[model samples]
Target: MNPFDYEVDILPLSVEDGGGFTAVAPELPGCRSDGDTPQEALDNIYDAIGCWIEAAQEMGRPVPQPRRAAA
Candidate 1:
């Protein structure tokens, strides 16, 4: 399954936060990325999700499934 299938929350960061876009996968704890643009943040988070899943699998940890889509 593609990691992109997982739900992601993208938000704008404040100046104190470095003023970049932040993308986070709520289902995958600590799986997030930041970029200058929304598209870039999303792209980075995709890679992060993959790595998160791979690392979990390697350590024999349970990888959370994607949340169900709303009707």
Candidate 2:
């Protein structure tokens, strides 16, 4: 039931563009992170999602549900 369970998209960045992977949780606006590797980007995005949910909860905002994965 963790909010970080939302579907994530990982994209690779070019060397001139800082050379890292970017992870984004599509269901949560502005919830994303970048890292030197794909795994690191995923890990960072999980933390970002948690923080985003917590902030939303603290402000009495509705937290969005995780989108089901495609079959």
lDDT of 2 by residue, 1-71 (tens): 48556899999999899999999998899998999999999999989999999999999999898878443
TM for every model, in the order presented, reads 0.91, 0.88
Best by TM-score: 1
Which parts of model 1 are misplaced by more than 4 Å? 69-71
Candidate 2: the clashing residue pairs are none
Per-residue alpha-carbon lDDT of model 1 for 1-71, expressed as tens digits? 47978999999999998998999999999999999999999999999999999999999999987876533
* Model 1: per-residue Cα lDDT at residue 40: 95
In candidate 2, what residue range of length 10 has the lowest lDDT sum? 62-71
What clash pairs does model 1 have?
none
Error in Å for residue 2 of model 2: 0.6
| Poorest lDDT segment (10 consecutive residues) of candidate 1 | 62-71
